[model samples]
Target: MMVKQYLNDLVSLFFPQTCAGCDVPLAYGEQLICTACWFHLPYTYAHLDSENASARQFWGRVKLEAAASYLYFKEASRVQQIIYHFKYKSRPELGLILGERYGELLKESPPFNRADVIVPVPLHPAKLRKRGYNQSALFAEGLCRAMQIPVAALCLARVKATRSQTQVNRYARHENMLEAFEIRDPEIIGGKHVLLADDVLTTGATIEACASVLLDAGAAKVSAVTIAKAL
Candidate 1:
């Protein structure tokens, strides 16, 4: 262990590790994100309350037990850069690290603490193949580590590919997401409280669709958490 640490330190000396959020050199004890950036990032304290804005967003749309996001996402901000890298730059570990940290916080919150399983919003097979990984599932894996809950990645699946939700209005987003997801094995989630996870929450059309399918497949209840929420 001592030898490995020494070699890692030597490597870092030659190629300094940089913070994912700010691109600054990380101090010795810091991991992916530096302490300053971590503290200054816009955290949404929504997990502490069941009636937060995130949960309210799903009020009339879906039967959600709870919902919350860890951070507030803004365009061209540090959170956005981190998420951009997490999804597009093959930095899946960033999702895991953020999810684990957020999961620890969620474990202290209500309905979220009662989750029996973690299920990530699935990517279409083609997209998954192209990306070489499911960013949401990586986040779920880290959440499971901290919450000590099981993850059911294959229980739900994206049945169809949809166009980018970014270029569309709310109605178009909802229409595009229709029938995009399906439950592959209802038995795994039946009678269980599922916590659906994703990288970000935007117009929330995708999450609403996933939660609807989970409920229809016999899930007792559905909650949701994301790394960030778009304003």
Candidate 2:
């Protein structure tokens, strides 16, 4: 045990884990994010209000149980930096850590707590192969750990690999995502309240499409959650 501890200490000395939110070396007890950075995150707490912006964005497009996010993502902000590390920098654990923390908070929020299953938005097979893992699926695993909810990672799939939505107009974004997702293993989603998860909420086209598939598959209700909400 002593030798193992020494080896672990040596590794830490040479390769310290930094806080995802602040890029600072984490204190001994800190995991992914430091306490200070955690306290400062732009939390939306949208779960507290059913009509929060995250939900409102889907108002006319799809029926939902709840739609919310953990943080506000702004360009060059701490939340963005944290997400950047996971989405583009290949730090998939960032998604899991963020989802676990968010799931802890969602325990007190309705519809979210009542969700029988968590379904992460899927990536195209090509993208999944390139990225090595689905960041959303990692987030789903974390939420499953904290919320004691099962995750149906394969219930929904992205059929078409479309262009990036960053440069697309709102109408075009919806069009681009149309028919992009299909329901698989509908038995898992049928008659269950599902909490659909993703990394970010921007135009929300992705979430809308996923929810539509869930509802059509007989999901009693569907709520949307994300690590960040891009405003």
Candidate 3:
């Protein structure tokens, strides 16, 4: 064991791992993010209140039981950079790490703790193939690790490939997302309080569509969580 540790330390010295959030070289015992960047992250604390901005975004549009986001996303901010890397730069593990951290906090929150199963917003088949992974599913995987709850990735699926919601108005977003998702296996979600997770929350039309399908499939309740909120 000592020899193995010595070899690992020698390897790390030549190729030091860096923090995902800040690109700073990580010391021993540090994981994806360094201590300093983790401390400086703009945590939203939205789970503490059901009426927080994240939850309110779904009000009257979708009947969400609760909602929360782990961080606040700002243009050119570190959170944005982290998410960009997580989504487009092949750093899916960062999504998992963030999700696990968020899940640890959600475990203490009453509304989120009521979740029976976690579901990730699905990617269209073509997009999933191109990306090689679904970012939201990776995030949900981490949440499962921390929460000890099962993730039902096959329960919900995106049946249609819509244009990006970026630069779109609310009305356009709603139109583009209409009937975009479908319940692939209603049995898994039936009578369960489902926690639908995504990478971020903007106008929330995508989540609304996902929640509608889950509710129609007989899910007892649906709540949403995201890595960040772009407000």
lDDT winner: 1
Report the C-alpha lDDT of model 1 over 153-229, residue by residue, as the tens digit. Answer: 99999989987788888777776786798899999999999999999998889899999899989999999999999
lDDT per residue as tens, model 3, 1-231: 999999999999999988877888998999878899999999999999878999988888989999999999999888988998888988888989999999999988978888999999999999999989999999999999998889999888898999878888877888778668888889999999999999999878889999988998999999999999996
- Model 2 off-target regions past 4 Å? 166-172
- Look at candidate 2 and tell me the lDDT of residue 195: 94
Which residue pairs come into collision in candidate 2? none
The superposed Cα distance between candidate 2 and the true structure at residue 194, in angstroms, equals 1.1
**Order by lDDT, highest first:** 1, 3, 2
- Candidate 3 ranges with C-alpha deviation above 4 Å: 1-4, 166-172
CA error at residue 88 for candidate 2, angstroms: 2.0
Q: Count clashing pairs, candidate 2.
A: 0
Steric overlap count per candidate: 0, 0, 0
lDDT of 1: 0.92
lDDT of 2 by residue, 1-231 (tens): 999999988888899989877889988878888899988999998989988999899988999988999999999889988988898888988888888899898987788999999999999999999989999999999999899999999989999998888897888877788778989799998899999999999878899888988998899999999988998
lDDT of each: 0.92, 0.90, 0.91
